[model samples]
Target: MEFKNVSVVKEANVYFDGKVTSRTVVFESGEKKTLGFMLEGDYKFNTDAEETMEILGGDMSVQLPGESEYTLYKKGESYVVPANASFEMTVDKYVDYCCSYKK
Candidate 1:
């Protein structure tokens, strides 16, 4: 993967007291994605749009909205979060991820 004629946001979107941060990238066609890193911690997040998050490095345990169990996702694994729902993430080690927002 290569992106042509795209813009990268200089500032990162920081969350969880700087435990998680991501850089925004906008494609020429107007699609957007974020490349991020998360430190060891647990986080709760809510979404306005459906999102697909792919683990790129390390490991993650996620509990999606309405779920009672935490599922482990290693590198190269992906999970979907529905719009208007919230999820819980437990990161035991530093992790890298790519998050793509759906239309």
Candidate 2:
């Protein structure tokens, strides 16, 4: 039982090591743009509205702009991407736990 790949929810033969992971966004927070990210790496984006992402698995770091500071997130960890937060980070095997609006 893993949420990594929904395609074969019950099979464990193929290397599900991010072999194929996707999301079906059924309902979004119409108020702002939302997205689900997976893999190992930081995302670069500048938005008028704040974006949120949850660290479902793997190690990751959050680096905010204008500061030489960073926040670290581990497995089962969650954090919010502040509005106007021009930040960049490196994700070490990071997967996103996003809107459960799936098929």
Residues 1-103 of candidate 2: C-alpha lDDT, one tens digit per residue: 2333223223322223643244443223323222345567556545345556565556567776666877887767766666665667676775555423111
- Candidate number of the best lDDT: 1
Report lDDT per candidate.
0.92, 0.51
Q: What is the alpha-carbon lDDT of model 2 when measured against the actual structure?
A: 0.51
The residue-by-residue lDDT of candidate 1 on 1-103, one tens digit each, is 5666889999999998899999998987788889999999999889988999999899999999889999999998999999999999999988899999986
Count backbone overlaps in model 1: 0
Check candidate 2 and list the clashing pairs.
none
How many clashes would you count in candidate 2?
0
Poorest lDDT segment (10 consecutive residues) of candidate 2: 5-14
Q: Roughly what TM-score does model 1 have, to 2 decimal places?
A: 0.94
